[model samples]
Target chain A: MEAILKVEDINVYYGSIHAIKGVSFEVNEGEIVTLIGANGAGKSTTLNTISGLLHSKTGSVTFMGENLGKIPCHKIVSKGLALVPEGRRVFLQMTVQENLEMGAFTQGGKTLDDDLERVYEQFPRLKERMKQVAGTLSGGEQQMLAMGRALMSHPKLLMLDEPSMGLAPILVEQIFDIIQELHKAGTTILLVEQNAQAALSVADRGYVLETGKVVTTGTGHELLESPAIKKAYLGG
Target chain B: MEFLSYLISGVSLGSVYAIIALGYTMVYGIAKMLNFAHGDIIMVGGYISFCAMSYLGLPGWLATLLAMAVCTVLGIVIEGLAYKPLRSAPSLAVLITAIGVSYFLQNSALLIWKAAPKVYQPVVSGSLTLFGGQLSVPYASVLTMAACLVIMAALTLFISKSKMGKAMRACSEDKGAAQLMGINVNATISTTFAIGSALAAVAGVLLCTSYPTLQPTTGSMPGIKAFTAAVFGGIGSIPGAFLGGLLLGVIEAMAKAYISTNLANSIVFAVLIVVLLVKPAGLLGKYVPEKV
Candidate 1:
């Protein structure tokens, strides 16, 4: 399997504070690879760096055989890389349809209707509330809207930062189910989550990050059953 | 009859304020900064139009178009040079920078054109006498009001329907999310400035035509009044700016006629204070509660 994304020894800093210290990871063409860690463990930072929101001081992020270092953050979405940012930052004031339209900002009108149909088919709740203001939607609905919005770009690789965060347990399961559904549909996903159990349950492979470094890498089952991961993340 | 005349003149003045206030509200909406230099842009537009007409012997319509084009370029240049670098800076810092730019433009105009006020030729002359000459409306006032209405409608459609307009709304809501969605936020902001400054040119021309005075300081007082009008109606709302401007104009006119000319400005500001105390978000602005 070809690696769709390759992150090599990237270091990032926020002013003088080094936030990401030499982190590296990869996701294959058709796989759900998750980076699971505690709060402030640099999981979101890694995803942000790949999406071109933050620049790394060292190393490279190669996506589809092209280096993403020079591309601006906005242009990165057109390059088939989309990030569903933390907290499901949907445009609160805009209508649901407008929010989805904004998602396809790079694609113009071609394939827009078909894409909207596809997204609506995937998320029927959004269709029912297509004209509703996004802020009025419940937390779970907003998550789906954010995910659906990213799919509008027809991204080759979808990077979701904490899609399950702040969601109810049942909604978390639903979100993970959608993740698995999209994975089976042949979309490559790079997920960052603090919910270790749920993440590992759906991920084909997982990396355990601690203090900006990958401490363990294995099949999802292996990480799920590992004693250290079980104790530290799985709440053994 | 006298009251009706004052009301008509007031509406005409309000129309000019409304046009200028649109520029303020738009830049404030997207850039989340008060481009205090906006009023000075109006002055620059006035000077540009004045030069094109007097020095170049251009027709009124051609001169207005030329002013709009020049101001559009000037707006983009100003954004690139002055405001773009301060994108991530604190809002207070941006506001101060805007003030600095305002003074710079004013001083530059002073040096270029001198302080002597030049009489501006009316783009439309004569008056329409109504109700057997008891009520008379200047043709310039009619043109100004009509121009303001057309601009307001066109701008409303442009903002609500255009792709760039949607991007501007997105950027105003969340810059990071907008960037992630592949919307070039910088370009959207530049477009906002361009539109706003172009409108400033139209407003400048209308203002000079109605009042017939052109000077470096011409845009300052009206600019300040328009800014107040924006805040009075709701700083970020297009329609709010329109309403606020017209109301402020009527109030000033009524005050000058019924009360005292010296007290007209005072009454206008006092009304704003009262309105703000009643609705802190302005008449049309949404009251977004702070997330604790």
Candidate 2:
């Protein structure tokens, strides 16, 4: 499979503290690749670096054969990589529909109607609350809105940072199902999650991260069955 | 009947304050800075219009347009040179920088125009006789109030319907998420300054026309009053600025008539203190609880 995204030995620092230490990963076309780790294991940091929100101190991030080092964070979305940021940072003052419209900022007005229809079809709850302010939405609904907003850009590779974070078990399962559905629709996904068991269950491949380094890499089934992963992450 | 005249004059003054307050509220909303230099921009606008009409013999409308254009460019330049570099700096640092810019503009105007006050020719002269001349409204006052209403309506529509306006709202709410969504936060901020400065120019023109005094310090008092007005209405709300400006003007006018003129300013400020103590978020501002 063709690699849609390639991260090579990227190092990142926040002030004096090193956050990501020479981490490397790749997501191929038509794959649901997950980076599973505990909190502060550099999952969000790596995704942010890829999205150009944070710059790497060393190494490179290449998306669709383009080096993303010099690209501004705002311009990164136009290149077809979208990050549904952690905490579901939807514009709180904006209406649900306005928030979704902001997601399609890089696109022309031509595709907006059709894109809105598709997003609404995916999350009917968002459509129901389209006129309501986003801050008023429930957590699960906010997550769906964040995801729906990202999809508005027609992203080639969607990177989700802890979409299931803070969600109830049922809502978490629903979000994972949506991830799988999007993957089947032919979009590559790079997911970061603390929910290792659910991540492994839905991921085609998984990379286990510990203390800013990838400790192990395997297929979903392999990671699920591994005694080390089960003890460390899956709660054996 | 006498009280009605005072109220009318107060509304006229309030309209000018409202225009200036719009400048403050908008820049504060998007850039998250008080932009203390905003009042100085009004001074610059007055000087520009004064020069255009007196030296170049331009028509009143043309001079006002020229002032707006110059102020717009100046706003962008000030934001780029003074505020843009301090984007990631602390709010205190930005506020200090704004104050520095304000002093710089005042000194520059002093050197260019000198301290002598210039008498501004009213852009619109004559008065409307109402209730058999017992109530007379100056054309300048009518024009100022009309301009304020039109500007408020236009600005409201622009912010609600325009793509750039939406981007501005997004940036104001969350800059990081806005950047993630491909909205250029910096450009939105610069655009905000441009619009604010242009409005400052209009306010300057209207103010000078009504009051008939033009000096480097002309913008300072009104600027401070309008800032007070913005806070009274809610610093980040557009409609709040309008309501606050009108109310402040009327209160000031009423105090001047009923109370001592020397105490009018004091009463206006006292009202602000009371409002803040009562509401804490201004009249219309939302109280966002800090996330622990």
Index of the highest-DockQ prediction:
2
TM per candidate: 0.99, 0.99
DockQ of 2: 0.94
Docking class of 2: high
Question: What C-alpha lDDT do the candidate models reach, one value each?
Answer: 0.93, 0.94
Tens-digit per-residue lDDT, A13-59, candidate 2: 99988898989989998999999989889999999999999999889
Q: For model 1, how does the per-residue alpha-carbon lDDT over A41-100 read when each residue is reduced to its tens digit?
A: 899899889988899999999999999988889999998989999988999999898999
Q: Check candidate 1 and list the clashing pairs.
A: none
Give the distance in Å from residue B176's predicted Cα in candidate 2 to where it truly belongs: 0.4
Residue clash pairs of candidate 2: none
Q: Least lDDT summed over 10 consecutive residues: which range in candidate 2 chain B?
A: B283-292
Which predicted model would earn the best TM-score?
2
Candidate 2 B-chain TM-score: 0.99
In candidate 2, what are the lDDT values of residues B9-93, reduced to their tens digit? 9999999999999999999999999999999899898989988988899989999999999999999999999999999999999
Fnat, 2 decimals, each candidate: 0.90, 0.94
